[model samples]
Target: MTRPPARPMRADAVRNYERILTAARAAFAEQGSQAPLDDIAQRAGVGNATLYRHFPTRQALLEAVHRDHIEALCRQAKELLAAPSPSEALMSWLKAVVAQGSTARGLAASLMAAIGTQEESWCRDAVFASASALLARAQQAGAVRPDVTVRQLLKLVNAIALATETEPDRDEQVGRLLDLLLDGLRATSTS
Candidate 1:
């Protein structure tokens, strides 16, 4: 019997796998899901076979890219938790979230699809929990209205990201729009 085609990757394969993931993340962020897998392999300085061995399909690549961004977004939320004020923290996080959502074409769509689905529900929950904590802080401080929910903020950011999808200065526009939204969230004084 022919020796089984070189039993899956050996110990060193793990390092190459990680490097491919890192390179793919950067390439996908810059070129979207359509970015050539060959380019990713080249950037990782790995052979095409290695890239294929790790990620078998285009969907796998796309999902990995999505997962990476979500992980980064969650990390950002943790950092924002240390902000000086609730309102400032919430606003800054929202802006960063929007920018993150806008990094690649169709990313916002994929995130929305995954938000409540069983596929990535745990990740979604973690993200929501982070946002909820910030939102509650803002609300309790009277910096944000009591009625706003994390889901609503997510919808708003998704909408804003979608609206500015093709704009040249999309992030700036998203920031201005978010400022308007946050302004409306402030408690109005009834003098």
Candidate 2:
């Protein structure tokens, strides 16, 4: 059975929703996915009831936050279709994925766990489709090796995120790691 589409929120409800999301984002970034709901409510200047109405559970709030990021990643993948080179576009999206995974100190573990367990996760499906399309395009263009799987690529990206989570210069570390990864994925002379 299909669920009905969500109804539009009233003006104040919309504002509350946005505020909650913003607060949740900052809280999650600062305190991981386990950030207190009351803290989020306080940060958003909303009542605890309001926060609960918007997101009933920590997992629910985490999903909402992740959904927003996944949608952006999907949009980015589509936009990158017009990039000069297929390989470059794929690498760019991969970098974005790494950054997303590393956004919070402990987010990658939660995300990886959710991706593993959430069989009906729409956001995860969208992310996989977007990633697969980019990978396929690069492979078809002969810029990347055909042997690589999207799952493998994602694991590598997440691994990069985990490895650089504590670095003082994470962006630079992630960039260097991504470059090394992309080089390995390149179509080699023997492959």
Best by lDDT: 2
lDDT of every predicted structure (CA atoms): 0.74, 0.79
Clash number by candidate, in order:
0, 0
Off by over 4 Å in 1: 1-63, 116-120
Cα lDDT for residue 59, model 1? Answer: 54
lDDT of 1 by residue, 30-50 (tens): 776568999999999999998
Model 1, residue 179: distance off in Å is 1.7
Give every collision pair in model 2.
none
How does candidate 2 score on lDDT?
Answer: 0.79
Candidate 1, residue 125: lDDT: 78
Q: What's each prediction's TM-score?
A: 0.66, 0.75
